[model samples]
Target: MPAADWRMARFAPHRTAVSSAQVETVVARAVGIFGLVFAAQTVPVALEQSEALAVGAGTTLMALLYGGVVALAVASIGKVAVTGTAAAFAVLYAAALAAWPLLVDDPAALGGPPWLYYLANVATSAAAIAFPLAASVAYTVLVPAWYGVLRATAPGGQADTLLATLDALYAMILGFVVLIIITMLRQASRAVDGAQDAALRRYDVAARQHANEIERVRIDALVHDSVLTTLLSAAAAETPEEQRLAARMARDAVRRLDEAGASGPRTVESVGLTVLVRRIRAALTTFAAPFTVRVVNAAGVELTVEAIEAVYSATVQAMVNSLQHADEAGRTTRRELRVRGVGTGGVVVEVADNGRGFALQDVPNERLGLRVSIEERMAGAGGTAVVTSWPGEGTTVTIAWPAGVDGATT
Candidate 1:
């Protein structure tokens, strides 16, 4: 069969698309953006007025401090362990925000009470999705708290203590807002993945249940058409010759029961065309009328156990009917069974007999031997059976499997 049909037969399970990009990617990008923002805005402000911020603190130390944050971000971008590096950077960045005041060389570089610089850290910490919501909120609050402490304790910061406290509270509130928003999106993604997985599981369960129902129906039909027919024939015996025929029918019933038990629904597989034909011939040995079997253009093709059983049982029933009814005038009948492989991996078999045939429409629905036994049984196995007859020509029962049904699907 084609690749497309095979995929339709077997489907892959659901998986989360969110995991395609690792969580580390989010952390790296956030850190990279934060570092860029810091370098672009704060670096110039700190070094303005002829490197005023680096007066007491050497330019080398200030440059190294900014470079450190950038280095951590860059390091986390590579194949390094994500959670460890992110945690380490987040923890140390808190310290860096706290130590900014100590690194200020000129008093003028304290630049707006020195406490408000931590606002930028709040935004950066908010971007760290790897951190738990609580941890992120804590980091947001911690950065500002460190700034507040240093500013309140600094010599000239005593009068601006209230302003420093307000800055810290503002940063804490904004940090939590960012955390909640990101957390909600993450939860939504997880919920979507869960729903998709649940739906796929339900589909698998439904498919299994449907297959089981079909199997049950097929088994019931086989029992009705094959088993009951034999029993009826055995019960109707009248003479020594008839008794022998009935005994053969009884033995056929026993053999069919054994085959049914041995070839269980779960353990069966696709059988070779020749093997199936041989089995059919053996199955019909009990029939009083002899049937010649032939195979044509059927090399390297296979039939599903279900399809095989369906065709075999239905064809046997057809032959039995022909022997019993086709030659009502007491004339010799000729029976032919043909199996062929045609099209793309397709199977076609015909049970044709050279006997007086009856009109098709005259068969009643009450007699389920043809409809239920042959037609319904074949349909269940994903195949079709068609019967044609006339007053002069013999009846032909054709059984076929579609072009792409290569074998039984387990």
Candidate 2:
């Protein structure tokens, strides 16, 4: 069987029980009404045959049974597990009906036609279907068969047989109608459940997206608080060196802010890598004095919006590091920032500074500018940023991000 069918089958017993209970409650009320009617008919017959022992005894028994069944059905309202009780009541009702004929002088003269008794029999038999499988089969088939045998020996045997056939047909039609109604109700319930499930899933997705956006905003706020404010304060420092350092830090923080503001590539379409590269190079020159930018094979490179933002941010960080730490203002003419397209697969952005470079090993562990902003950001964007620097030699910061052969970033 298919997986869904198997699952539904496993759940069917519980669903059946619930549905059966509902059916039983409705059927019970109907049966109670029928029982009341039957008991009432017995009243006049008992009055007319006041001295007949069999008639009086049968009338009393039927009245008591009908009253009891009515009480039981009323008490079991909204309860589905009363199938067995309902079945017992059905048996009692059938037994009472059979004995009722014997109570009157002429059973056919009691009320209506003899066919009415058959109609009542058919209605009672149809009520049996509300019970669980075993009880329903026993009451529906066996009780009717028992009645058939008893009726066969009666004086108006042909009439009883005809009534029985009509009742049987009525029972079948009633069963079919009940089945169709129940089926339609079940289908409607399932459709409502499916719609609710879909609505919940959509809510979950929206919640997750909102949480991500909030986190991004938080990160941006933290960057502004720690980096941007400090740089702005440093920019107003008395000494030129402190002012330059502050300016560089402020510029770094600003670039980070811009990148953060640009919703990740996941939220947008592709952007040209060449244009992003040129923009980064220009920003670096604007932020730091006398910075030389060289572009080699930077044409025809396109990347996802997020990847582009990541690459741009990393390039800006490299430039900021060169401007702040690289002591090349008095020694070298300018700092070199090279942008290159690596083969047909990726783009490599190299920021090399001829300054008093610090050893990579000597860099402090808590420095988040390189670790968090550069390396972590690149990694999240499915790329890597490498920083290679040693004392007395030039520092080279290279950021590599995936690029399609036709210059598209996935």
Give all candidates' CA lDDT scores: 0.62, 0.58
Kindly report which residue stretches of model 1 are placed more than 4 angstroms away from their true locations once superposed.
Answer: 1-31, 49-80, 109-119, 122-130, 152-159, 210-410
**Residue 336, candidate 1: alpha-carbon lDDT:** 89
Question: What would the per-residue lDDT of candidate 2 be over residues 322-374, giving only the tens digit for each residue?
Answer: 77888754686357877777654367777887788888888898987788778
Q: Give lDDT tens digits, candidate 1, residues 1-410.
A: 35475345544432324421234356456655666566566655455422434455535544554665565566556534545655665665566565555655565544445423533453345335557766676677667676666666542244366876886677667666666656665676556545544554464455556556656777788788778887887788789898898788778877877777554443123444544565566667888777887776554565554565677778778887777778757667788888887742568878898788888799898978888888877776667778889987888888777523433221
Query: How many residue pairs clash (N, CA or C atoms closer than 3 angstroms) in each of the candidate models, in the order given?
Result: 0, 5
lDDT of 1: 0.62
Worst 10 residues of 1 by lDDT: 13-22
TM-score of predicted structure 1: 0.42
Position 389, candidate 1: lDDT: 90
Q: Which candidate is the best by TM-score?
A: 1
The prediction achieving the highest lDDT against the true structure is 1
Report how far off residue 89 is in candidate 2 (Å).
Answer: 2.2
